[model samples]
Target: MENSPSVKSVAYPYGLMLAIYSILVLVLIYLMNIDQENWVIGTVNSLVTIVLYILALRTFKKKNGGFMKLKEALKVGLAIAAISGIISAVYAYIHYSFVYPEFLDMMYEKSYLDITERNMPQAQTDQALELSKMTLSPLFFATTTLILNLFFGFLISLIVGLIMKRENPAYQ
Candidate 1:
């Protein structure tokens, strides 16, 4: 246990990676709302995120060890993802609950109006509103957020492990 690296050593990589992802998400949200036809922004953002995550993974490996075992890498990556998810989700909750309590209402009203204007089915609008309300629940939001981020982490770990694993040659 004494020889095992403490969790503190992993914090920096986890936090820095999340910060980068968050910035990308904010930009994506802004672009998406600004121009529906400019979905290229999202594609570019996702590619850059993958590249950044890979870079961060390489950096973490270099700093932590030349090679990281699969389980260890997965653990560190998931830990980071979980922390970031919780932080981001909490911020979202606060933002919606206090900073902009009317956002949900506004969204519901706009969606309902849009549905009517388009002569779309009323059930679609009602379903969207219900889903929005469910998202307002802290527990559900946090769990889903964590699961989503952890899924990304798992993918990053799979790639990083392929690049970073260095099991000793058994014959040696």
Candidate 2:
């Protein structure tokens, strides 16, 4: 009988693909001069993530003779998420710190405008901008990116795993 593929073996390649795809999208957005806070970009990224998770789970199921446990699916999904998150975090750090130092300033300016447009009092606006500055730092960005990826990844994995789980007859 052929050996079943390991989670790492299946996940690493998919994770790398996801990271590359995400970076490419970011580059495309930047090249096209789209706002960093665009909802369309977020929607696209979310859809891509869901599709990749489904594809990865399908690949694993196919390799394992069309059977996959919930645990196996969860493991594969989380592994892919972690690997991709780490790579993306590193890239975010470098991109924010060096490749586009002005990006933070732009975000800050946008935030200020948004707050003022809401007719926020001066004190509240000052406080909000202060909070925004901290949140927009490179370290904060990298950490938040990793955390949000893991969070959304887990949610996607849980739902997908529940839907796709098929126990091996021999093990039942």
Candidate 3:
């Protein structure tokens, strides 16, 4: 525990990585004309996120004599993702609600079309569309984005921390 760096020590790298990732997302949204409907773009962005997490953990290990406890690694990883999630949630709400208010409607229309293509009854299609709309609502989108971020971050941290964990022989 004494060997591990303080959480604040890694703050700069964690925050800078998240900020860059967020900006990259915004850039992709504008340049590639991407929206949440296309899961591929988001998946690509997540690759960068994974790299950032690994780097953060590696940096922490380097600073703390090339060792970090699992608990502390989880703290760093989750904290980075959670705070990043909050930042992203705010951005998502503002972008969808203000910058491109039509985005959500576009998603609904696309989803409706996709669902109707299944050849379901009109009543069933309507019900499905309504449910889709609820799921894609601004509030739900932001909230789920935050939760998913934390959830995935937790998983990544556990795996990475396990791989990176090393005990101080002297302390042991």
Worst 10 residues of 3 by lDDT: 11-20
Best by lDDT: 2
Report the Cα lDDT for residue 35, model 1: 56
Off by over 4 Å in 1: 1-4, 20-41, 110-132, 136-143, 169-172
Candidate 3 Cα outliers beyond 4 Å, as residue runs: 1-3, 35-43, 119-123
The TM-score values for the models, in the order shown, are: 0.65, 0.88, 0.84
Ranking by lDDT: 2, 3, 1
111-133 in candidate 3: lDDT tens per residue?
98899899999899889988998
lDDT of 2 at 86: 93
lDDT of 2 by residue, 1-172 (tens): 4456799988999989988987788677767878877998888888989999999999999999999888889899889989989998988888889888798888889888887888888899889889988998999999987888788778898899999998887776
Write down the lDDT that model 1 would get.
Answer: 0.61
Specify the poorest-scoring 10-residue window by lDDT in model 2.
Answer: 1-10
> lDDT tens digits, residues 140-166, model 1?
644666677678867877777677766
lDDT of each: 0.61, 0.87, 0.79
RMSD of each: 4.6, 2.5, 2.5
